[model samples]
Target: MNTEQQVETLQSALLARARALADETLARAKHEAERIGAEADTRLRVREESEQASAKQRAERVYRQKVQAAEIKMRAELDQLRWAHVQQVLDALQERLTTLVEDDAVYLPLLKALIARAAQAIEDGDLVAQVNARDYTRLQAHWSTLAAEWVPGKRIVLSPEGEDCSGGALVRNRDNTIRVDNRFEGRLERLADELQRIIVERLFATATPLAMRG
Candidate 1:
């Protein structure tokens, strides 16, 4: 073979090697780009899922807060209604006592019982009894019987000063140091809490929902 032919062959071989290297480099670059794209897609999916979870938790918290607020408002309203009803029942009781005082047959026995109860509280002492104007005259007429039956062996003075009250009397010791109130209005007031509780129980047991009765 000649020198020219050998040179041409060598040039062809070098060109073929260069083309193979270029193809290999392009393939490596494409593989690197695909790997980077796949990693970015995976990161995007993870971020989206995390954001959705956080939003759901926030929604649930807000819902719970709203429910709690509504329950509080409802309970306050229910308490207000119960208080109004209790007042009405107490007013009715007061009206009934006032009516009973108008009947002499009922009022007389009740008044005597009141004086006896007041006198029993102060044993063996000089006591002054004060009653309403109408009751004072009647009681003065029956002083002998009342003195013997209720307060024996004690100086009992009926006050002409007379109180503005129901059938019962207010009896005080000699020096005005101790006093007993046996008035119908006072007795009722002292038991107001117990009366209100009873009223609530009867009303709720028959009229209200089962859940509210407790």
Candidate 2:
């Protein structure tokens, strides 16, 4: 063949080879882009799921805190109400005691019994009996006869000075070492804790049974 014809054929072959290389490179680039897009989509989905889980946990924590706070407030209010009720009962008991002291038919015997009890508790001592102003006068009038009947062996005498009490007697030895406080207020004070426990058990038994058990 002639030189011109041969050169044209070689140029055509080289041009076809260049076109084939361009097509292969374009296909590889498209495949790489598709792979990168899929990876990005997976990463985005994972991030969104993680964020949702964290938000749910935070919301749950806040809900628990609010519930606990409400429970604490409710318990505090109940405690205040229970204390107020207990105080009211105690005040009523004090008023009842005051009324009892005003009735002489009942109070006079109770006073005599209190003196006898105190005298018996002393166990062979020269005793001085102290009482409130009203009781001191009543006892001073017939102390000798009552003393002989109440405490036969012990030398018993009423004090010139009256005691500061509602009713009952305060008997002590001569030197003030041994004593028996049979006064109403003194006895009530000594039994205050037991009284409060009983009051709480009776009043709050149905309302807060678990709390009462504690």
Candidate 3:
């Protein structure tokens, strides 16, 4: 009950209270630190997974784009090559055609064949052959023999007309009603496309691809 005894009791109680509060504060701080560490670890793992997925997606997109671009470029190059090859082939074919037409033997046979074809078309009567002044004399020398072979069952009289012609002869009756064209160059010029086509087919039979000439 004395003042000294009361003072000692109060001091001991205050010391015990301080020790208990310090222990509680330390435990609470440790618990908070553990929670914070777990949260940080979780956030790090999530970020790493997301970044990996994004990187994989980007890589796949780049690969697909590259592959597609390469395919398109390849097709373009192939088309260019194909067109170039076709143009070269056509140029060579034209040169070959010009050479064949300029040859003597080839031109002669072609002229003879055209003449015979026109002569065979003559009607079943007497025929008067009309030609330009240039070719009139030439036909006169060979008229009899040519008619004999050209028109087997008909008679032909060779006559030179005043009309201007490039080459070849025109056969007409006395009345000049029905006529046949047998000109030297005229007949060939008319049939130029067909003749060229045939010649090309024969000469370039072993070529890479057949020509489609118009």
Q: Give the top-scoring candidate (TM-score).
A: 2
**What TM-score does structure 1 among the candidates reach?**
0.70
What lDDT would each prediction earn against the true structure?
0.79, 0.84, 0.65
Off by over 4 Å in 3: 1-8, 88-214
Point to the candidate with the largest lDDT: 2
Evaluated at residue 211, the lDDT of candidate 1 is: 39
Q: Count the backbone clashes (under 3 Å) in each candidate.
A: 0, 0, 3
Task: Tell me the tens digit of each residue's lDDT in model 1 across 104-144.
Answer: 88877787788777888887478988888887887788777
What is candidate 2's lDDT per residue for 30-119, written digit by digit as tens?
Answer: 988888888888888888888888888888778778777776777888888888888899899988878888898888788888888998
Judged by lDDT against the true structure, how good is candidate 1? 0.79
Writing each residue's lDDT as its tens digit, candidate 3 over 1-214 gives: 6999888888878888888888888888888888898888888888888888888888878877877777677767755665555446555654664465456467435444645555567554777766666546655787788677766677777775643654546767777777777664455566657765665555555646322221
Q: Model 2 — TM-score against the truth?
A: 0.74
Q: State the number of backbone clashes in model 3.
A: 3
Worst 10 residues of 3 by lDDT: 205-214
